[model samples]
Target: MKIGIGSTNLAKIEAVQRVFSENDEIISVRVPSGVSDQPFSDEETIEGAIQRAKKALETTNADLGIGLEGGVTETPYGLMLCNWGALYSKTDHSPIIAGGARILLPDEISERLRTGEELGPIMDDYCMRENIRHHEGAIGIFTNGLITRGEMFSHVVRMLKGQFIYRMNG
Candidate 1:
């Protein structure tokens, strides 16, 4: 079946591809609707994702349409808030919603990020000891030996995939 994904991020694409690989019947996955390169607020992210799926379905006429959106949120509580949502539409245009983990950002980094600075660039500028994923690695200079983008994205994708399946069957 042809599936249309709604983001240009290669990591998202790779995650979808990995999930689909397990189901050989899925013939293709393409991103037909992409969002702006800039970051979107939490509500905008979900709305944009839904809009993209709708647009992709209308344009591609695929068997399924998928939308993934990432957002950074702040809470009054001590925990950091970073969550992403997923939308899946069937051929009939019915949509299902899913989401990934709320990866916490350090208070200091989150404060800077809230000021509209891009995460990676901000990290690089500040010369943090952690990577973007707030992990350790080659990107560790900024992350302070925390997590890599790949690792974070992998976890997000896994959560999303599980949620997708749950929504599919639920």
Candidate 2:
């Protein structure tokens, strides 16, 4: 099957690649999230994922499209970093949505996020490294590498794929 992923980011792409079979053709394309760069709510983040999935499917004209989005949502305790994944199937006009892990952001990061700063750049600066988002991600830094950005998103993709298979079979 031909699958298109709605991001050029290596971590997100790696997440999808880890879930799908080797026989499937994976196409990575940069697509707009159709939302704020730093989505601040669960609703916005999921919307971004769905939009990316649909846009990627259209852009690549593939049978399926996948989207992964990372954002922060405000919780009672603090701002929490959240990740979401979506799969859109052209044949059935169906979509499977799943979410991964969430970690409370430190005050320093939350404070910067509230100032309209994006997490990727903040994490990069905080880690004193470049392209952390494309690699380990904030979750990795927070978890001390226990859960990487790609791994978290890959878990979500696994859920999405499993659910999609169930739906197809039923």
Give TM-scores for every candidate, taking all chains together and pairing residue i with residue i.
Answer: 0.63, 0.98
Predicted structure 2, TM vs. truth: 0.98
lDDT of each: 0.53, 0.93
- Candidate 2 lDDT, tens digit per residue, 96-157? 89998999999999999999999999988898899999998999999999999999999999
C-alpha lDDT of residue 77 in model 1: 61
List ranges where model 2 is wrong by over 4 Å.
Answer: none
- Per-residue CA lDDT of model 1 for 1-170, tens digit only, reads 67666655555555566666655333223443354432445565566556666665555666666665555655666324343545455633455555554556677867777667666556655664434433332233334547444344456556655766776687
Task: Count clashing residue pairs in model 1.
Answer: 12
Looking at model 1, residue 26 earns an lDDT score of: 30
Residue 165 accuracy (lDDT) in model 2:
93
